[model samples]
Target: AYVITSRCAGFKDGACREVCPCDCIYDAGEQFVINPDDCIDCGACVTACPVEAIFADIDLPAEHSAALHFNRAFFES
Candidate 1:
């Protein structure tokens, strides 16, 4: 799964949603979020984000690790 970090909060560019083959990305209130269960780990969304806000779950920065849980909760709720 790829997580959308704070950098995407105000800049929901949405390019990631457009290229996602699985259609796992969604328009959350402040930023776009990826559905971990639906994501295929294709890495397409990472390149599509103009703000470079997407990162593989394993590669996420320490401070941005919370984004992973946030993304999961988005879909769970």
Candidate 2:
């Protein structure tokens, strides 16, 4: 699954949501989050992000690692 990171918090370009083939992305108040369970891991959202905020869970940047958890929590809650 792809995690939407801090860069998207206020910038919410929403391009990712449009390109997501599986419709796994959602607005989480401040930013968009990808539904880990629904994401197909096809990498479509990554390229559509204007801020480059989307990253695969395994490839998440060190500082953005927490985004992987944040993404899941949004759905869980």
What's model 1's overall lDDT? 0.90
Query: What TM-score would every model get versus the actual structure?
Result: 0.96, 0.95
Clashing pairs in 2: none
Q: Which runs of model 1 end up more than 4 angstroms from their true locations? A: none
Per-residue CA lDDT of model 2 for 1-77, tens digit only, reads 78899889889999898988888899998888999999999998889887899999999999998898899999897
* Model 2: lowest-lDDT 10 consecutive positions: 44-53
For candidate 1, the per-residue lDDT at 69 reads 88
In model 2, the runs with Cα more than 4 Å from the true position are none
In candidate 2, residue 32 scores what lDDT? 88
* Candidate 1 residue pairs in backbone clash: none
lDDT (0 to 1) per candidate: 0.90, 0.90
- Model 1 poorest ten-residue lDDT run: 1-10
